[model samples]
Target: MIRHLVLFKLNEGVSRDEERVVAGVKAFQELDGVVPELTFWECAWNITDRPIAHDFAINSAVADRDALTRYLEHPAHQAAAARWREFATWVIADYEF
Candidate 1:
């Protein structure tokens, strides 16, 4: 399986409480049902206030690299990512399990 993990940092002046950010997070949270390739999905706001911590995170799993690619290419995922791109930057890591 491929575990796809991401950490998101909100841009300056952006807050997780903002309606747009909330909706963006919801969009990502809903991806488990939208993308067939995704076998697992978990997304949430970060509760920690440490300077090194990000504002949000996504932890997902897929069967393989091909499934991961499909998940990435899925339209719903693309739309959610575009919305987040406006207010946040992210880093990701994929690992096999």
Candidate 2:
């Protein structure tokens, strides 16, 4: 399996609450339904007083390299990227075995 993780820095005008960010991340559940290769997806955000993560981070598990490739090029992913690009300053992603 491939473990995919990403940390994001949100744009200046975007809100930075943990629950709201988690809600946004939960939206990936829908993508999993549409894109079969994604075995798991989850995200969390930093808190106001207690930062749980750096900015925003996503953790996903996929079947293999091909599955990861499929997830990356999927239309559902593109839509998700477009949604995130609107309020993200920058994003860092990594994949592991």
Candidate 3:
């Protein structure tokens, strides 16, 4: 099995207001394909003073590597990604167990 995890940070000068962020989050949930088993989260913790730190802020767990690749290549995901690119930093990792 494969495990795909991701994290995101909104841009320094472009913090999304709570409402917009929530909307975006929901929009992501509504994506129609390339996701089989998935989960997401939004950050609510204060972690501004730590180094080597990345809270699992804005995360998704894809069920497998194929899903991860398909998710990235999906048209709907591409649209959302274009929007996110302007105001986000992201990390993705894949693991096997």
RMSD of 1: 0.7
Best by lDDT: 1
Show where candidate 2 strays beyond 4 Å: 16-26, 48-53
Distance from true position, residue 61, model 3, in Å?
4.3
lDDT tens readout by residue for model 3, 1-97: 5555556676666555656555555556566334444443233423565655553244455656676677678777777667666666778777764
lDDT of 1 by residue, 1-97 (tens): 9999999999999987899999999899889788999888999989999999999999999999999999999999999999999999999999999
lDDT of 2 by residue, 10-37 (tens): 7666775545445556565467568888
Report the number of the highest-TM-score candidate: 1
Off by over 4 Å in 1: none
Residue pairs clashing in model 1 are none
TM-score (C-alpha) between model 3 and the true structure: 0.59
Clash pairs detected, candidate 2: none
Locate the minimum summed-lDDT window of 10 residues in model 3. Answer: 37-46
Clash number for every model? Answer: 0, 0, 0
Ranking by lDDT: 1, 2, 3
TM-score of each: 0.97, 0.71, 0.59
